[model samples]
Target: METVRTIDLLLDAFGRIPPLLADAVRGLDRAALLWRPEVDGRQGNSIGWLAWHLARQEDTQVAALVGGEEVWRAGGWHARSGVPYDEAAMGYGMTTDEVGRFDVTDGEVLIAYYDAVHARTVEVIARMSDADLARIVDRSWDPPVTAAVRLVSVVDDAAQHVGQAAYLRGLLGGPEAD
Candidate 1:
């Protein structure tokens, strides 16, 4: 596919996430949002934590791609989220305990944070040229990562998490949860 078309597809995919997530958690109270299923005596991730993780990942990864400050800091999301974490915390490699500590009870704010990050992602991708997409962004892998690869990775991660959130909401027995 042409590079611009590819980016446009990515933008459309990314644009769908926030509303899907919003629908998934609609009518959920703070307690419901924080509910976790148990497997093997350990609590699974809650809807709140998953949503926060997705937002943080997108904010950090997109910021890196664009060579700009993260929306978490630049757009005041850290304070807006009222989550009591440092600006750079993106939920990667966190311990179970650390994951359990994510306590953003207000679903509206969480969705807003995701919206801001998604907007920045769309803005950045809209301006990218084919040459820009082909440039290597990370050299740590056996095959260096290109900007296109990184963006695709973000999309994949976001899709999985959002799907999981929707599934969990269904499991929680909310109306029209599916």
Candidate 2:
């Protein structure tokens, strides 16, 4: 039996996220994309916010690994998104108010941004070598983090957010959801 290369496995896992994200926001209007289950609570995230965060996360992490510029900046997504936030904000450590402030309401734009970031991720993964994967990318952790581990973490985080987006879509009762 031929063992699958690690890069192939990572690529396969990463490939699944974008389509799920697309389906989650498909056919959703601006209201639906921005809807939150609780107007005064922090129990849920809007579909638009979740999609943006996930794309930013993947874009930043993968760009760091590959030593390339993020698609958010290089692809002119900030201006195109008209998100009213800085280019560097990736939804990490964001307060409830800040999350609420993310006002990207166009589902098509959100999906397009995600698709662009995902394409960059796929390109980086395709070009990674065994040595690159084994190289340590971060040393702040106790055991240190390798490129392979960082890639896996990125994929895992993306999968969770995409799943959350899909759940929100179902909760909001979209036509193409569920």
Candidate 3:
């Protein structure tokens, strides 16, 4: 595939996916939000947990990509000394099984929060010089991936999970699957 602008890729992913996923969960009643499908025999994460997890993962990985290595290295990021970080990390929480249980049940807030995070990521990428992009850094256990790799991984993970969330929503009788 031809190389594309990172900003283009990021925006495209966000624009195409979030709405569909959000729509999938829109109008869901409480039980629906907490609905768990038995896929191969196990209960899947609830919409609330999924949303919280997605936001946490994205915020953490994005911070890492931009040089904030320890932003979310531990569970403490979600604890007392960590509420601020956790709030930034997710926008949701771990205890809640589905989106309906979150402090902000409005899908719009979740969508907007994700957009803001993506915008910050883009800004960070833009600020990186070519050298910075090519520079290798150890951000995880699987050896060092370049700044570029981390950046792409962050976007890819977000998109993949958004799709997952949408799928879960569909399984729960969301609009997309109806």
Lowest lDDT block of 10, candidate 3 = 75-84
> On residues 1-178, what C-alpha lDDT tens digit does candidate 3 reach at each position?
9887655665565456556546655666655655666668656666645554565677677676665643334333344221223345454344323333444344454555555555556567667777887778775747778876776776676667777777777666535347
RMSD of each: 2.1, 1.6, 6.0
Q: Using lDDT, give the best candidate's number.
A: 2
The 10 consecutive residues of candidate 1 with the worst lDDT sum are: 1-10
Off by over 4 Å in 3: 1-15, 68-106, 139-143, 174-178
Deviation from native of the Cα of residue 165 in model 3, angstroms: 1.5
Which residue pairs clash within candidate 2? none
Task: Supply the TM-score for candidate 3.
Answer: 0.65
Per-residue lDDT of 40 in model 2:
62
Per-model TM-score, in order, reads 0.92, 0.94, 0.65
Q: What's the lDDT for all of these models?
A: 0.84, 0.88, 0.57
- Indicate the TM-score of model 1: 0.92
Model 2 spans > 4 angstroms off:
174-178
Model 3, total clashes: 2
Model 3 residue 148 CA deviation in Å: 0.9
Which predicted model would earn the best TM-score? Answer: 2
* lDDT tens digits, residue span 1-178, model 1: 6454877888888888978888876667888778888889998888988888898898889888888898889888777777756668888888788877777748788888888888889899999988999999999997999999999999899989989888889888846455
Q: What is the Å distance of residue 115 in model 1 from its true position? A: 0.8
